[model samples]
Target: MVASRSQVADVAANAFRRSCLMARISTKEELRRIIAEPRPATRVKILDSLDEQSIEFLKRCPFALVGTTSADGTVEVSPKGDEPGFIRVEDPKTLLIPERVGNNLAFGLNNILDTGEIGIIALVPATGETLRISGTAEIHDDPELVASLSSLGKPALLATRVRIKHCYFHCARSIVRAKLWDPKAWPAPGRISFGKIIAPRIGESEAVAAQIDANVEGAYTTRLWQNT
Candidate 1:
């Protein structure tokens, strides 16, 4: 007699459930015993009181990763970058970041508007060190602020101003392992334009693909990195 398909599936499911149960620790005490001891907090220096060094680090950082969470608890981390010193450190507890043209999804910005809680990690490539700042963010379209940041002739849409809660320097272990700053270790693959990648997925014809390729390439070479 041969086992039916449903019987085979049921047997497999039961085995998986049994395996999961066996893998789980029986109690909180068991979990605590199995886990490693927590690290001491002595190494972490609080940023509630910032000094000139922390302020200077924020000012010199050209790129940052902005993390936000929505009311429904959906998390989003997005990269924001521009010419050096794009993020203006208004004071020890405040920072201003310009919002440039993107896909307009505004997922990160929208999350900030809803929850206000934000986390930022600033990276200075040459130094291989990073700084993390966490706090609240507000979207601002102030005319004076926009005008000041747009000195390079590009128009600003909005600026994200953050009220920092805590700031700290992250270790360089990950960067060292990845060899991120070593150009010799970089992978050189065939260059593909963003238009080429999206055209097929979006069902665009050959003519439309060429048009998009030109448009996207022009915008980047002309406006986005013009200052650099």
Candidate 2:
């Protein structure tokens, strides 16, 4: 006998619950029992504001991962990239990230508006170490600042200014282990199909999905610095 759709969903939900409940660590003591403690220097390395080394690091960073959380507890990590120095160092304690054109979801932007909290991991290409920063953030639409962040001659719609609270250089163990900077260790590239993923949910046909795929590819070239 075949199971109903609801019945199959119930079975899957039960399995997920069981997996979540298995071997869960509920407290710090339980967590510490398994993972080793950080070294003394690790605790002291976090700075309240950017130091000279960190400021220099930011100057060469062309990419960063911006993390934010909404009031409803949803977390969003958006990748932002541009030419080196896309992010401006307003001062030792503040950073300006230019908002670029992309999918209009605005998940990260909305989260900053709701919570004012943000985290960022600045990365430079061909390097393993990453700079991690956490702080309060605010969305700004100041005309002069936005214009300064323009890329390809198109001005940014807005910017996120972060006030530094904690800043540190994260170790490169993860990157080194993954050989992230080594082209020789890279795996074959994979393709993502937004059409295939969204078609069923939106009640669309394969033709619509194909159009979506084509539009998405077209946007990569036409919409990088401007709206389509």
Candidate 3:
């Protein structure tokens, strides 16, 4: 005898329910064994001071993510980029990074002002290695420093001076897993057009997307020539 569509659906659902009920249930200890494991301390040596290796890595890095926390406990991470070697190492413990044109929200800078504690992860795309630095940051608008970073007569808006506390070389596990530097693994440019994705959420039109794209391209171009 053939069953109706509703009857067939009910029969399939009952089979699924029985199968689920027959499956082995996990005890708390079994669950803990699967999920909880103590992390072994990484035995890599920490640099007592920023050495030539660290400085060279910082110089070649074109991008860094700055992490900061506010006194009230808000956290922010901001992306900073410029030409290669844009970050200057004044000394073993001191580094300077120029602040260029941004939206002026200053979320990361404000966090620095409130807490003084900051973390930085610098990445060199060509090589899969990354450097991590934890330190205190001071914001400066000194004309001399700003002028030194300016190019084609455009002055830097600000400069951040960081006093290094701990500097370490991070393993490439994350990069290797993500295939970050693999050209073949990159997402296609048109997969999700920036305009289509952002316009509605931002209440902006395609013009806004065009403007943002143009600004980013222009900034990157100008940054290459700036300080030349």
TM-score against native, each model? 0.80, 0.88, 0.70
Assess the local accuracy of residue 80 in candidate 2 as a C-alpha lDDT between 0 and 100: 94
Model 3 clashes, total count: 0
Which regions in candidate 3 have their CA more than 4 angstroms from the true location?
Answer: 1-44, 151-153, 190-228
Worst 10 residues of 1 by lDDT: 219-228
- The digit string of per-residue lDDT tens for model 2 on 1-228 reads 999999999999999999888878998998999987998988999999999989999999999999999999999999999999888999999999999888889999999999998999999988788999999999999999899989878899999999999999998999999999999999999879999998878999999999888988888876566567
Deviation from native of the Cα of residue 8 in model 1, angstroms: 6.0
**Which sections of candidate 1 miss by over 4 Å?**
2-38, 41-43, 189-193, 225-228
Model 3 poorest 10 in a row by lDDT: 37-46
Q: Please count the clashing residue pairs in each candidate, in the order shown.
A: 0, 0, 0
Tens digits of per-residue lDDT, candidate 1, 1-228, equal 899999999999999999999999988888989885556663456566357877777667888899999999999999998877888878888888898887678999999989999998889876677888899999999988877777368756788999988888777888888898888998985556776777888999777778877877776777554332
**lDDT of model 2 at residue 20?**
88
- Output the lDDT of residue 91, model 3: 92
